[model samples]
Target: MNLNTFIQKKINKQLIFPFIILAIVSGIFFMSIGFRTTITTSKIELEKAVEKWNNTFTNMENFLEFLSYDNNLIDNTEKLGEILKNFYNKFQNKISYIYFSTSSKNILIYPETDMINGINPNTRPWFINASKNKEKTQITEPYVDHITKDIIITISKYVNGMNISGVIGIDINPSFLNDILSNKDLLLISKNNIILFSENKNKIGKTFNIPTKSERFISKNILLITKEAKGNVYIVTYKNLFLELLPYYFISLVSIFLILFLGKIVNKNINTELKNSIAMPLETLVNEAKNYLNNQTFDSSKITSNIKEIEVLINEIADMISIIEANFQELKATNEELLDAYNEIEKYSGELESTYELFIEKMSNIVEGFDENTGNHIKRVQILSEFLAKKLGLPKTLVRQIYLYSPLHDIGKIKVPPEILTKPGPLSEKEWKIMKNHTIWGAEILDGDPRLEIAKKIALYHHEKYNGKGYPFGLKGELIPIEAQIVNIVDVYDALRSKRPYKKALSHEKAMEIILKGDNRTSPNDFNPKILEIFKKYEEEIKILWDNLNDNK
Candidate 1:
């Protein structure tokens, strides 16, 4: 077969493999999207279940307060029984039973119409827990009652009106939660290690043993969620299968194997055709070209090939080489001129760099003239600011800017009277107000300098507290630029460490203790709690930087 004919046949055959791969990849992508959507919906439903349970408890609590007034508080067992019976009737299908108890003692049991509340469950695990535990309320797992044998979740609360009085407990059925957590096989375990509720019926009320494979993947997620810390939600997803997609995976794997087997047969056929069409023709052309070069009389008319493009390209190349030899001397002269221009451009670039350096040096001298300490302070603050910015996971460009602009931190202090700058005593209220204005003054100095705007913003607002009690403008929380917040922490660290006219330098440990006490402010006005937490995390490194800067000085 001709090489072109073989290649065309192979190209048509390759189309089949690509289409099959696309179908498999598309199937996986769609399945992934569907799985994620199901998980999100289930999460919303779980939240709703929690909300419904909370509201139900609140309603029962309101009833407990009302019943406490007339019913015997000292001998509440019989009265509680009657009250629970009423609740069962009121909510009907929503609530299955009402059981009241102290952590270790059962006060009452009331059952739904479908359940039998014949025997008292005073000694049951949930009842005993309700009677003794002083915690507000403990919700129990799903368990079958002794006589009625229906599954239910129990909630208990400690009674504190007069004396320790014991706890009141309520039981709820979990059939409503099943519809919501339908996406995954879910298991709700109690604090006592009993499975309270589960979509997987086989697991309900059973003790959980960590499966060997799931130990690493899901154990930590389960632990974190069970704690129920405010705003603490966790995802414990792992591989799973749906009823519909099971067949797709099986079929896809079989298809891949069959395609692989067929691919070997196709490849063998293509290889045989390549030897006859491509390899044999290329070898023949190379041998003919070598023979003509050895004979020394190259005639273009002697070379003819069945491949049309290769033949045309060979004929044009021979003519082109003859034209190149004729023009070689003129081309060499023009190349020399281009080299000279490149050298001149390099010289100009070097001069520009030298001029830029000289400008920076002159500006540095003028800005930090009075104290050599001013230069070191700027450099150190910039370093510290950059460190803080990076530690907080800021973008690289932002961190670089903070480092470059921190020297302008005290640019506003330049406007303060020299006497105040070196004052040995605490300033009066009026003088203090003047000192605080340095931030505002510094901002104005760098305001129009496009180069220093971010630095100016830091200088202007870094001293502002998280609680809106800070000066110039009482910008609070995230409203205060992160750059300013970062500079604020470093500024305080530097201030406390440096020898001042009024107070002795504070120890690094003491400085850290005060900043971290977080007693700074939240409601009244002060630093952000979350931001403060970030600062505290890097305290050790911050202290190291402070020590290094002081030593260098």
Candidate 2:
């Protein structure tokens, strides 16, 4: 019947119960598998810890055997000292001290101790036990050191040579032994039922009575895997099953949640498909028809649907829309032709503007040539002006304007007498007055064109000073256009560096010094302070531009 009812019925009848069953089954299966995996992983980790402890204890036994090989135990004092030094350095953190006890009442200790030579070696349990059993190494129970007062275990071997019978003993910190036992969930227990090393420090040095009956042991829940180390036995216990299964339980919970969430998403998508296949297509066709009636334009693409009734309805609406769209397209084609004609007219207008700009640029160049300025000088000023404008963060359009119009800064020189403009000697005050009026004349010349607005500003105010002592308009500080300020500094710098009719070209260093520090006709005050700072920052770049454009070079 209806799409919504059909989709809901399909999901309820086929999907919901099946998904619920699958979620329950997957969660139970995952928990079973995961719990077993976690238990196995714990067992492997515990075994690794035991193997590591066994390896370390074996190394100690090997070291003791190495020490027993020495025949001249007392006479080879330097050799023994070197051996002890190496052992102490390597195992210093674990072994507090290592010493050799001889039958002659002498003790040689590593990390030298204050014990006197006359002390009896037989009085010590490690020495007595090792000396008694010459074949096997002895590991004595934990004892407080007499000197350091720290808990220590002694690993010793009895040594017998031609004239020597003694014990080679290494006193290890019990903490090092505890580290191995505790890491593996193990306890080091003595034959006397005393816990020597355990993960729980309170149990160490404490005795635990063993139950006589197997039933009692089972009731007490005592389970252990034992490994004998010398005389002591290490007991490994299983980790808590609940704690080990936590991660697996968490994963199972997540999997169930994810399954349920996916079921909801699938149900949502079914409803969405119903809407898209029936309701959305019908709504789109109605809206498109309304848009065609009101706005004379409609989407011509066919409306798609999966439902037979909806598809047939969409086809009928599409046929009516097609006829309306045809009339609209005919009008659209006519309007496009009119638009093309207007664009063609605009293209011709743009070409005329470009021609006018080229004419202005050529006129500016002619004026510069008449003023005895080199073509290269104008080009260099344009480069320097553009650099300063960009460094000052001017917009790209303005920066381009500065580059294009900077050469026109002296266009006013066209009205000045040629002889006066190219004078090889310094100008008199009256002649300077006339020369200064060129700024006013240049502004007037470029005043009529909107495209030359930037050029007009530069021509009028290029000679103006930041400190207000400049000519023509006497504009000061920010009163001058930034474009004019940019061209002014660059114009002055290029003029100083270029060989003019009246002045020889100066070195870049000398020219910069005069520009920054002031000369006869201009000073640092003549330039904008910000512009000056930008010029200084890019001083090297400007100098390179100058050198490359130098006509004399």
Which residue window of length 10 is worst by lDDT in model 2?
211-220
Q: In candidate 2, what are the lDDT values of residues 141-211, reduced to their tens digit? A: 66666667765668889876556567888887666766665554566666666676666766667775653
Model 1 gets an lDDT of 0.62
State each model's CA lDDT, in order: 0.62, 0.76
Error of 2 at 496 (Å): 0.7
Task: Give me the candidate number with maximum TM-score.
Answer: 2
TM-scores for every candidate against the unseen true structure: 0.37, 0.40
Query: What TM-score would candidate 1 get against the native?
Result: 0.37
Q: Cα deviation in Å at residue 373, candidate 1?
A: 61
lDDT per residue (tens digit) for residues 1-553 in model 1: 7555666467547845675676567566656665555556445554555555446656765665555454345354555567677886886555655656544444565653423234444666556655565544556556666655767666656555344365565666555545433434444555445666666677776776654222223343332122121111112222343543456556656656666556656666766666555555555555555655576344565445566775776677566656665677778878888889889989999898678645544454455553324325555677788988887788998887787666666667777776766667777888888888988988887788777678789879988877777878888788898888878777776766666656677798877666766343222225566657776787788778878877886
Q: Which 10-residue window of candidate 1 scores lowest in summed lDDT?
A: 224-233
